[model samples]
Target: MILAVLLIAVQVAAQDPRLDRLDPDTRAQVTAVVDSARLAGLPAEPLIQRALEGATKGAPGPRIVTAVRRLSVDLGTARAALGDGASVPELEAGVAALRAGATPQVLANLHSVRRPPLTMALSVLADLVASGVPADSAAVAVLALAPKARDADLVEFRRAVERDIALGAPPAAATSIRVNAGADVLNAAGPPPPGPALPRRP
Candidate 1:
């Protein structure tokens, strides 16, 4: 019994070292939130990381708590969109995509393509939207290129679009040009190559 108790204590302490920095009440609140997320089978690590990020940035206790709670909700939404089998990284990317106006249907469709490591594609989609591209246009553009483009290709595409946008091109036009360019490359190569490595998540 004593050994079991010590093991439990160690487990709890290992959950979040940053929790030690929080005041007692705030720590308790955050711990409760983390426990609830774990119980729900959601990835609680992101929430813990978010809280730690906030704390490191010198945010107040309430704000840190709020950020963690919000991330939990986002993770839940992402899981619902991506289905039960979604990895934590997939869910994280999905949340960012959702926040940038990608509908759950869009997310589902993206996942249906059977591509792994969609983190960069989803992030590029979000970045496009955040850069003033219409969400629908961004989705269309991303979906068209993602199935064929490698991670390096996606990075180049994003950079091209950004450059075009900086040069006074409309977001839609810039995205279209880059996506079409990718298509051109694919057509020139003939037959798709093997899939690229999984995306690296932030």
Candidate 2:
């Protein structure tokens, strides 16, 4: 019975289509990392997906392994920053934000103010950094807008910053100007009225 069960487990494990795309040694390494991630209560899907992405790009086994391992570490760091209650998408975005140089303290501060679906805000921060905005400046800009900016506001803000940069404004200067403009608009609107109480998550 034990041998049969082991055989069934092996068959099931072999069914992941991604595994077939890797050489035996690479497959073994990735599987081990994925299993370790699972045991750590981390989502393994991103790591798996990253491995598949590497394979699709024809990366070597060692390269794929390195990518997966790095993503695993990033995801773990994201989880630590955002806490266990964070959703998978939130964690993913957090990883991107971290990679773009958003500090852990910045993430924690954002978590304190924003509700779920922080993906958009985090992505915008990453975009700003990628577009040459200094990481600290980008974090400040995003955090300033995050308290009151809706999803549309975030999109518009990103476009404005990008446009300014394209127009030859220095990234830090452009971001600072836009962030200040946003703050002015908020201040002009007066204090926000109290809404329904959002229960704090422990």
Candidate 3:
């Protein structure tokens, strides 16, 4: 009986206390969504965090629940594109990529062209798209660099794009010019690393 009590205490303690800030009904709803996501082998913290962010922003309860539900779906979609080997940050970044207008095929193709730990590349892709670069152009630019650009290179590339846009260049034109300049040598570094690594043939 004592052991059972301790186990129950452990389980209660394991729950995130910040969730208590939510109304009981909203808390239960969000918890159900998070639990479902957890069972599906996806990260749950992001969903909880999304809920908390909504609550903090003074969003309506229904809105918070809807956002969490949508994010859960987005995470699953990202996982399918990135595969099981992807880290939580990579998956979250993939969610950002999708939200920023990148297609699932682009995400999957990124998985094929790049090695694991795709967080930086995914982040830059999302940033470019969100900054108004056309999604196809953003994906093209990112895929061009993913082969040989280091994390630092991606950061610099994003900054350069931002600068050009700030200087009145069209987003797509900026992305295209920068990619050609930065990736010319890297693209010639030999084709993508071996193996069939994605969801589609293309």
Candidate 4:
């Protein structure tokens, strides 16, 4: 009986319930803040610690609450935008942009281009997909913006588009682009012909 009691004591001690000490409304706010930090790719433990410290240091509850509330709202927006498939960096970027007040249209436009050397494209696409954009729309938009894209960008974009379509970018969108997208983009963006194929080999 003593051993069981000791074990129960240890388990109870292990559970840190600092937030539970706060009023219900304040606890909700604190949760929102911490969750927001997580969504924004920020470390929540530190933020929560900081808030706790501030509270200890005589900071007004309202101020700490407000700060946490703001952070929470920003995180909520970002997480909503990102859906369920975003990576850390993508979440960070999307959250930052959302915090900075970027619109969905702007995000859509930005998603279409693969940055130089093509290295940035895959990550960008992965993030966009996570953030609730349709795979077909995202792929098509990215390809459309490939004229100014780098070679690496094209390679990665092709890979991502294929992956998305295979996983399902919608039959209609997939068909529209697969049949003609690559050819058209290549024709437009590819280097000029070698002087009409050297006059058809005489």
Candidate that scores best on TM-score: 2
Q: Evaluated with lDDT, which candidate comes out highest?
A: 3
Which portions of model 1 miss their true places by more than 4 Å? 1-15, 194-202
Residue-wise lDDT of candidate 1 within 6-57, one digit each (tens)?
5564466446777888877777788888877775768878977887888789
- Model-by-model lDDT, in order? 0.80, 0.85, 0.86, 0.52
Task: Give the per-residue lDDT of model 2 (tens digit) for 1-202.
Answer: 9768655544544467768789999999998787767656688789889989999999999999999999889888888877777778888999999999998989988888776668899989999999999999999999998887776788888899999999999999999999999878877887567777765533
Pairs of residues at least 3 apart in sequence or in different chains that clash in candidate 4: 82-130, 82-131, 118-153
List runs of model 3 lying over 4 Å from the truth. Answer: 1-14, 187-202
Residue 155 of model 2 has an lDDT of: 81
Give the Cα error of residue 113 in candidate 1, in Å: 1.3
55-162: candidate 3 lDDT, tens digit per residue: 999998899999999999999999999887788999999999999989999999888877777899999999998888998999999988987787888999999999
Q: Is candidate 1 or candidate 3 better by lDDT?
A: 3
Candidates by TM-score, descending order: 2, 3, 1, 4
RMSD (Å) of each candidate, 1 decimal: 4.6, 3.9, 5.4, 15.9
Q: What lDDT is reached at residue 47 by model 4?
A: 46
lDDT of 3 at 85: 74
